[model samples]
Target: MLAPTVGAEAAEAVAGEEAWSVHMQNTNVLQGHTKIRSPYYGTNSLSQAPQMRQTVSLDLLLGLRLWSGAEAHLDGMMWEGFGMSNALGMAGFPNGEAFRKGTASPNENISRAFIRQSIGFGSEMEDSPSSSLFLKGRQHVSRLTFTLGRFGAKDIFDSNAYANDARTQFMNWSLMANGAWDYPADSLGFTTGGAAELYLHDWVLRYGFFQVPTVSNGISLDPHIWKAWAQVVELERKHKIGSHPGAVRFLVYANRANMGSFQQTLNNPLRPADITDSRNYRIKYGICLNADQEIATGVGIFTRLGWSDGRSEPWSFTDVDSSASFGISAKGTAWDRPNDTLAIACIVNSISKVHAAFLRQGGTGILVGDGRLSYGAEKIIETYYDFAVRGWLHVAFDYQFAVNPAYNRDRGPVHIFGARLHWEF
Candidate 1:
């Protein structure tokens, strides 16, 4: 049941929500990395040779007001490209836009189709921010919102103003998100689910339930309805530090799916380390903290901390048990380039002891397997500069340096360079 609009008769109420809205965006990313040290290679290993890749994506978003406090949105998306080394090899992958299942030929999909019902609880109203997924209108300061349909879990949880969007911010898997949470998603990152959000002034609480891929990191979602699913809850607080704004979010998520265990795989003598052989319905959970603060005018800093019980195999997201990241985002106003942005971030990713041992015995997850694990933490540093070319066009340059690439100490640090072009209005 939908919550009735409480202040529909007022000018600043929900009735004034947008009648219709349309937005479009396109992006092209090209990246390359030079050869790196590789004593050996496994079924899933970063290549030892120089490599480059390009990816392109187009998105069309439409929104319509359905009733006093309800709206619907649809996303038409097309993507074509491949990640370097087929999107494997690194736990903290450098390119956020790259998907594991890449295609040279263009493909289309209905990435998002959802309906949202908002319940206002206060008379105080404020203008909503611009977004591809949300309709613009005056909204209650304290309200409850319910959304149902196909979308990305990130759309409602673990958000940071400075480090969340790959198109406009730091472009690394772990930098853009808490790698260890492994929130529900299919191969392309979208999932079918429902979420509820309760906003009260500077604080909010959110929860979501989503479907996971039937097979680890596979594109197809589970067919058995709620049998294979994931759930997440988050609490967020917003406040002013000095005169600048800041926010912190704490998230916890659990997944129950047909998954394998690292320790079990290693214990099975017949099959030295085939995790899939021991698949069973199991529950896995994790917690993540995300924070961002605007320290000064046009200058903001962000950080994320994450951990998960690593006994079970990674079901969808990359295999990471412990993760931490810190970064700075600054506008170029000091240099008089008001529309330019410069950002840098660093990420550290690691697996549990049992996970390391499993890999040591030649087991593999979604990414990062060297056949024989050297058991070193994967570390990465990334920087990018983006400048506006026109009203709806922008271009960026990016670079990344990684040590112990793919958790193998035998491999030397690697350097990757990239460029991106984006258009949206």
Candidate 2:
């Protein structure tokens, strides 16, 4: 609930047609796991014992219309708690809310402070509805939009309506974004960057450049922007399939950072070949294809396929060099509950031969590091049901089954269960 002062400020913004607006939301998620089989464990391995974990987050969004076609926004966030196994082991982590830097107590920070400018090119206009960060207004259909400041790479790329937001949709990290893109970010999953988008009729083009962490999966970003940076470009098309709407996006990304090569790490016999020990300003590249379609009145299907250069170690994302994920979501209108949702998805993740060899030699990456390697592609199946308790509250039950977790055949076929509660106003 909003305090009286905040409520009054919101009312004034609406009533006076003021340029400034404020919105806030909170989400608390509780996820638990049932024990599975595991003969041994490593430093980054998931525990075979049953465990439960919870995370809580709060976000306050403030937006100000600086001038015609320009806006400034800020996001203040507070996060707390950890994920199962401290968010390690799996190439596709189970909980999207779990951050590598999670703490038992709450931590506050400014997640985003940015400026957006839109330059219209065509006379055609469209309505832009109000959301968590965008203000309600109308804008030209053909325009060039630029955003600058601190934010998340996922905030502007690889978006799927049926399977994007973890707070309201799928909970798995692989389902939330293309795992092989390795988009740049710190431990908390955000970075300082800039993005530009060109909108045309039925098509859009996007490009972004962002900062990378100082080290692989590290918490601090590199200060020397010229020495380390990540770039991404995407082309998106909107189409109709038999009177149903659909969209497809093709994306490519490159990162130039102080990173190590998989083969180089393995070939160095003088020392225990570790990726982290041999950092140099090298480049890594990847591509992703994402698509979504509405097949029926209340059903939608989405898929993502991604691949990265197998030679280099994963810098900012997971350990997967190749990935494919597909899912379907349906509304519960048939059961007289229009606001409820049901979804299921399957994901397959694999590393390169060199990466497998490195792991076989007991080399560790960001997430997976079994003592020894029994290489196999990691596969997962996930399902969830979300029930809307009221206008502003929702509850969800989720389950996941994994085969060859962390790409190790010796480990498990594991089962995981979760529950989530979310509220926004």
What lDDT does candidate 1 reach at residue 354? 93
lDDT of each: 0.85, 0.85
Q: What is candidate 2's CA lDDT for residue 374?
A: 93
Q: List the candidate 1 regions with Cα displacement exceeding 4 Å.
A: 1-17, 270-272
lDDT of 1 at 46: 81
Give candidate 2's TM-score: 0.95
lDDT of 1 at 241: 81
Candidate 1 structure quality by residue, lDDT tens digits, 213-246: 8999988888776678899999999999889999
Alpha-carbon TM-score of each model against the true structure: 0.95, 0.95
Estimate, for each residue in 1-425, the C-alpha lDDT of model 2 and write its tens digit.
Answer: 01000111342244334477777777777877778678877777878888888888788888888988888888888889998888888888888888877899999888778898999987898876666666667789999999999888888888887877778888888888888989888887889999999999899999999999998898789998998999999999999999889999999999999999888887788444578767799999999999999999889999999999988888887888999999999999999999999999999999899999988888888889887889999999999999999967889999999898899998887888898887776
> What's the distance in Å from true for residue 319, model 2?
1.1
Instruction: Report how far residue 131 has shifted in candidate 1, in Å.
Output: 2.1
- Stretches of candidate 2 off by over 4 Å are 1-18, 270-272
